[model samples]
Target: MQIYKVGGCVRDRLLGRPVKDKDWVVVGSTADEMLAQGFRPVGKDFPVFLHPKTHEEYALARTERKTAPGYHGFEIHASPEVTLEEDLARRDLTINAMAEDDDGNVIDPFDGQTDLHNKTLRHVSNAFVEDPVRVLRMARFAARFGFQVADETKLLIHQMIANGELEHLVAERVWQELEKALLSNQPSLFFICLREVGALKTLFPEIDRLFGVPQHSQWHPEVDAGVHVMLVLDQAARLTDDLAVRFAVVCHDLGKGTTPADILPGHKGHEQRSIALTHALCERLRVPREISSLALKVAEFHTHCHLLFELSSCEVLNVIEGLDAFRKPQRLSQYLLACEADFRGRPGYENADMPEKAAFQACFDAASKVSAAAFVNEGLKGPAIASAMADQRCRIIEQMLKPFRKNTGGTAS
Candidate 1:
């Protein structure tokens, strides 16, 4: 049996990226023969083994046929006769279909190397349409590598959408791909690619509806709620690598889609609507509580966070307490980051500073320092202690923000 290094490792290496994992394809090998060696069986549906030493995956060279629908509807055929080329042909993208031998010889049967050189993402074969997940995967790859999808590949994706292939994709699989795309270097491309292939409306209708929605030109020169969201997502990526923050930013403006047309570009009371929409979307996707919780908080209070400098000390303290900033300071910081991204996402505001963030953080720092033990030591009990804590926290915020309020000539409103 001849073993060859294949898939992402080879692709990454060719692109001068640090290889994180390695997968091997064993050509001319049977399951019995693999077991006779030291490889441990691990694959549930097909022939995959674990190397006894390195513990890396070693899947047998195999070919598959589409049977029913979705990604799971595949019939696998693996035997000693299966060629490495045949196995490569079943891959999604041409750039990922290339393999490498032990002697450092590169195999490019589908012109993966040529496509790589051209910075293009092309499909491997006509079989690419068989799996609906490939549409998401290719979009994710576009986000990760910043590569343009070939015309033919785009055509195939459109065809897949027309044939109702995307409808078969499971929610978990969709979330999995979406989470990965959000963490990519260019997360906006993921949504852009999905929109191009008409899958965004199917999978993320809430986000899709934002495309034509208008926003106040004074606050959002970009105007379109969808464009604003994409910009916010990109800015969130720039600020932090936290997936929770990025996801919150992505859903922060969902309420804008539901704005009343008679109100034109104004989006009054969108915050509560955004909170409801975020909850519904999170529930549908089975998103983790930590992510959904942060998202909900940001959706509800992002406007509060933005207007912190203009609000009263009591208002600032109320916002901070509502976010549970004292107990979970990290969540507050994440919320601020998302808010900052939103502030700077609009046209001509990309490089603008967020003084409100720093001011709010300072207020939080001062209030968080208020000793609960001090209040309890004053013979205060239960409800009395809670009132004393709120009073002290508000006083602390007032003291810290006094100078800024005076400078702006603004009263506690």
Candidate 2:
């Protein structure tokens, strides 16, 4: 059997990116032969093995035929007779179809290297429309690499959407691709790419509807809610690599999309509306509770976070307690990051300093230090102890904001 490094490893290497994982394609290797050689079988639908020593994945060179709709309705064939060329032809993008041999020889059967040089994402074959997941994957790659989708590939993606292939995509697979996109350096490109191909409407209608929605130009110079969210996502990526934070930023403005048209730019009470939409979107996608919880909290409290300076110490503490900041300080920090992203996402404000973030963080730190143990020490029980804790935390917050209130000539509410 001849083994060659294939897929993303080769693609990233050619692009001068750090190779994160190595996948091998074994030509002229049977599943029984691989098992005999101590390669552990891991693939359920195809012949994929793990190296005896390195434990790296080794998938047999195989070809696939489209049998039905979606990504799962494919007939996979792996045998000693399957050629590596045939296997590579089944790949989604040209850049990902290239492979490399042990002797350091680059295999370019589909001109993937040329497309890589051109900074283009091109399809390998007409069979690209067979799997809907490929559309998401390609969009994610565009976000990661900042590459332009070739005209032909764009047409194929449009055709796939027209054929209703995207409707067959399952929620888990959609979220899997979305999570990857959210973690990319330019996550907004992921949504832009999907919008270009009309897949966003099918997969994320809530987000898609935001494109043409108007926003107050005074606050959001970008003027479109969709563009504003994309800017927020990019800013969020700049602040943290946490997927939960990124996801929260993405869903924070969903309520704005549902604003009454007569209201035009004003989004009064949108925070509550956003909470409901966030829940629906999360439930539909089967998002994890941790992420959904954080997103919901951000959706409901982001406005409160922005209005921290105007709120009373008690109100600020209430927002902090609503976020469970005392128990999970990291969530509070993440919420601040998402809010900062939103605040700076507008045009001519990208570099604006956020004094509110620091002020809120300081307030949270002071309040978090007020221990409930002291109330318990005074023989306070249950609701009494909880009441005492709230009073003490609010007092601490009040003291913490005293200096800032002087500078602004504002009194506590």
Q: What is the TM-score of each candidate against the true structure?
A: 0.95, 0.95
**Could you tell me which 10 consecutive residues in candidate 2 have the lowest summed lDDT?**
260-269
User: At residue 238, what lDDT does model 1 achieve?
Assistant: 92
RMSD of each: 1.8, 1.9
TM-score of candidate 2 to 2 decimals: 0.95
Q: Stretches of candidate 1 above 4 Å error?
A: 261-268
lDDT per residue for candidate 2 within 96-160, as digits (tens), equals 99889988899989999999999999999999999999999999998998888899988998898
Which residue runs does candidate 2 get wrong by more than 4 Å? 261-268, 376-379, 409-413
Clashes of each: 0, 0
Clashing pairs in 2: none
Q: After superposition, how far is residue 140 of candidate 2 from its true place, in Å?
A: 0.7
